[model samples]
Target: MQPADGINLHSPPPKLKFEKLSAYKKRKLSHSTVNDTSPPTYQISSRAEESDNSSVVEPDKNLMAEYVDFVKVKPTKKEEVLRILNKKDVTSPKFFQLDSITREDMSHWGLNPGIIAQLRDNIKKFEKHLTPQ
Candidate 1:
């Protein structure tokens, strides 16, 4: 006789993953998008900065002259990235060659290009909305 209390004989269930609150919080730092869907966490370092300057730390004992070249201008706005992108229209060939990128790419890091395009098109329209009506 088949017993209802026993495990299923036909197939087994897929393994599941559960995230611990502390571990999940740490993971959140790696990808802030897990909560905030708007805006991004990082962007290009600009020409004034070394390609890998994102995490470079300056020590007090370090000579100013030696690290003079590393001084970088902080990005003030999203328009800056948009401005560079505007230079060529569409995505830049050189930009695609980058070794690393931010949370927000040409296609939301290409997670879903279709949705990214739709949102970008909306942004274009909204910017134009500010024009003379």
Candidate 2:
């Protein structure tokens, strides 16, 4: 009796196999069992033919510069601050209080206005932590 799908599953399926390119070509070229009218013919051509006259296009430097100019570089302000802060000899709130690093300097280094107060507080805390009780 057939299943509900009404499909016949009586015989085992054919086993899958593969042959080398040379063997396959020989088998196809000679007829053994395949009863097809004509065997498929493949045309292989080389792409390095000198008859090809297509020239490689060079990119415009000016056009590339226009696009590249829009890329924003990462600011080294945080690194500068960390370098100063990590200095063993320069661990004082007075250093921050000195006019060496001004609001203009912060702005030039791409630091926000709010970072000034935060830096001051961090410096104070760091100073307190470093000093004895």
Candidate 3:
């Protein structure tokens, strides 16, 4: 029935002594006041307007050309493969033969595995559609 330690049970815990902050310290701790009336001024560069017109316009044209080249290059082989697959009167056997070669070529095409798998699945569906019952 007795407490384990010899310490008194009913006595209040010792009060914590915190030092009072001085006025300077209190001001440092408080949120800083921002001026709301005047709009903030930005330091505009002297070359900003000239750079804006030159840099912006040039990059966009270069980007468009690069983008066009990118578009032309990336999908050209895939488009070729698709066009071959969709050719008139292509038999199932021929399709499977082409698919095997194309699958090998696709590993070199820099395609993701999931996309290659999907393409394989699409080829299978196309072959099924082409085959007479």
Candidate No. with top TM-score: 2
Across residues 1-133, which tens digit of lDDT does each residue of candidate 2 receive?
A: 3344433455433442445568776886666336666545443243212212223323443422222122221244444444434442333333444455566665555545565455543544443554699
What is the TM-score of candidate 3?
0.22
| Candidate 3 residue-wise lDDT, 44-110, digit = tens | 3442322212222222323322322333434545554343433422222223234234656655655
Q: Give each model's whole-structure lDDT.
A: 0.38, 0.43, 0.41
Each prediction's TM-score versus the true structure? 0.18, 0.28, 0.22
Predicted candidate 1 versus true structure: per-residue lDDT over 59-96, tens digit per residue: 33222211111222133523343444444343322232
Ranking 1 against 3 by TM-score, winner: 3
* Candidate 3 global CA lDDT score: 0.41
In model 2, the runs with Cα more than 4 Å from the true position are 1-94
Candidates by TM-score, descending order: 2, 3, 1
Per-residue error for 115 in candidate 2, Å, reads 1.8
Model 2 worst lDDT window (10 residues) = 64-73
Residue 106 CA displacement from its true place in model 3, Å: 0.8
